[model samples]
Target: MRSLMCLLFLVIFCSVQMTSSANLAIEVANSNCCGVFSNKKIPVNKVVSYYKTSSICARRAIVFKTIAGREFCINPETSWVRSHVDIVDKRTATPP
Candidate 1:
């Protein structure tokens, strides 16, 4: 009876650990935060699309996805970054 209780406890502990890890993974995957910004200037024409980082992020930034399937995080306040975001937005905007 004691051994059975121990085995049940072990199973319950493992289940809790697995549940916590899965929750953490899901949170990380859902977070669209950028830890750092890239200083490299990506040509506006090369950017196929762009998106702003989530408000929950520590820093305000823009993410630009290039035609070559690469993503760059840039400071939203930068002049070039703002212009690039504007251009990309217009390009992707749906017709009224």
Candidate 2:
């Protein structure tokens, strides 16, 4: 009975630790703003390079790297960026 109680306590401690770790990871990911594209706007087609998510920022911005190597953040809700994203997704989904 003592051994069972110890095991239960261990299990509860591990679960709480996991939950805390997961939340910490999420908060860290959402706290850092993208240095390359903090506040700028540009056309989607002009984006020579781009990334899809908050991997580069605190929010869900479409980070675009222009031909000049200048980075800009564009809202993902814009029609231009959304349509281009759809096209890219469709293209990549096709079998070569």
In candidate 2, list every pair of residues with a backbone clash.
Answer: none
* Candidate 1 segments exceeding 4 Å error: 1-29
Considering only N, C-alpha and C atoms within 3 Å, which residue pairs clash in candidate 1?
none
> For candidate 1, lDDT tens digit of each residue in 3-55?
99999999999999999999877876897889999999999889998888877
lDDT of 2 at 31: 60
Candidate 2's TM-score reads 0.47
C-alpha TM-score for every candidate: 0.67, 0.47
Against the true structure, what is every candidate's RMSD?
4.4, 5.5
Cand. 2 Cα-lDDT: 0.67
Please name the candidate that would achieve the greatest lDDT relative to the true structure: 1
**Lowest-lDDT window of 10 residues in candidate 1?**
80-89
lDDT per residue as tens, model 2, 1-96: 999999999999999999999997887776635544354446555556666664534567776667789766667776677776665466447587
